[model samples]
Target: MSKPTALIKFKAKLSRPATPKGAAWTFLVLPAVASAKLPTRSMVTVEGSFAGQPFQATLEPDGQGSHWLKIDNVLREAAGVAAGDSVALEIAPVEKEPEPKVPADLRKALASNADAKATWADITPVARRDWIHWITSGKKAETRGKRIAAACDKLACGKRNACCFDRSGMYSKGSMGAPEAAE
Candidate 1:
C-alpha cells in the first residue's frame, strides 16, 4: 500500500476513560482525522507521534462512527500529557499488520491439534489477535492456561474468536474485572 504523502495532523484533548462503559484509559484522536485515512478495518494500526514522541498504536472505532488511538500510561508519561490536555498528533496508516506474539504454551497446544491449527489459519487476523489477547491478558498463569485450553477447544469446534471480549475497549472494566474509579 502506498503511504499518504501528507501526514494527518490534529489537535485533540486527551480524554480518559473515554466513556463510562469503556476501558479506563486515555486517548488522543479525532473522528475527522481518523476518517480522512479511510481505514479498511474498524481497528487499524497506526504509526504516529504525539508531542514529538514516536509511537505505534491501533486505532479502534468509537461506536459513534469515529476512531480513537489509545494512549497508554507509558506514552502519556513520555509525552508529558494528561487528560484534558490538548496535544498535537501526526499519524499515518501502517501498511502491514503487526502479528501478536503467541505464547509458547499456546503455540505448543495449537501445534498438537491439527484441526485447531487449521481453523486458526482460517480465521481473520483480528480474530486471531483477540484470541491471543484473551490468553495473554490473563492476570494469572492459571487464567492464561485456562484461556489457552479454552481457545484450543473452541478452535477445534470451529469457533472463530473468543466471545465476551471487549476488543473495542468499550464496555471493558479495568483488567476485565473492576471498573475504574470515576474522577
Candidate 2:
C-alpha cells in the first residue's frame, strides 16, 4: 500500500507518570487523523516537530489502538516542555519500514548459532525487531551479552523472540515500564 503523506496536526498534552517509581517518560498521544487507521502493535516512522524541535522517530502503538510520541529528555529540553504542558505537533507518516540495526555482539552470536540464524531469517520483521530490542535494551554490556546469549538459545529452540516482552510500549517491561501501568 502506498504510504500516505498527509500532515497530521494536533495539540497534545505532555504527560508523565504520577508515581515516583514509575518510568520517567513523557509523551504525546496522537489522535486519529485523516482516514488512516494506524496499525496496532507496529512501528510507524513519523517525521515532525514537537513544539518546534524537528524529530524523526518510529512511533510504537499502544495495544489500545493509540500511538504514543515518546518525548525524550533532549526533546523535552529543546521544546521547553514538561509534564502538563500543552504543545502543538505536526507529523507525517513515512512509508518506510524501520530497520532496527543488529548490534555487533548480537550479530556475532547469531552468526555462530546456525539454528538461531535460520530461525531469525524465517521470523517476521516485527518479531525480528522485538528480538533486536530485547538484545539492545540492556543498560550494561554484561546484560546485553547475556540477552544475546539468551536470544540465541531461544531461537535455537524455535522461539521467535523474547518471551513476555511487549514490543508495543503499552505493556513494556524493559528499561521503561508499562505506560498504562504508570497511570
Whole-model Cα lDDT per candidate?
0.74, 0.74
- lDDT for each residue of candidate 1 in 1-183, tens digit (9 for 90 to 100): 575645778788787762566554676556565556655435667788988899988776554445667778888889888887999888877767777667789889999999899999898777887898788878899998899999999999999989888764546654432122235
**Decoy 1 TM-score against native:** 0.62
In terms of lDDT, the poorest run of 10 residues in model 2 is: 173-182
In order of appearance, the predictions have TM-scores of: 0.62, 0.63
As a whole number from 0 to 100, the lDDT of residue 102 in candidate 1 is 74
Q: For model 1, give the RMSD to the true fold.
A: 5.7
Residue pairs whose backbone atoms clash in candidate 1: 21-171
Off by over 4 Å in 1: 1-6, 18-25, 103-112, 119-124, 130-183
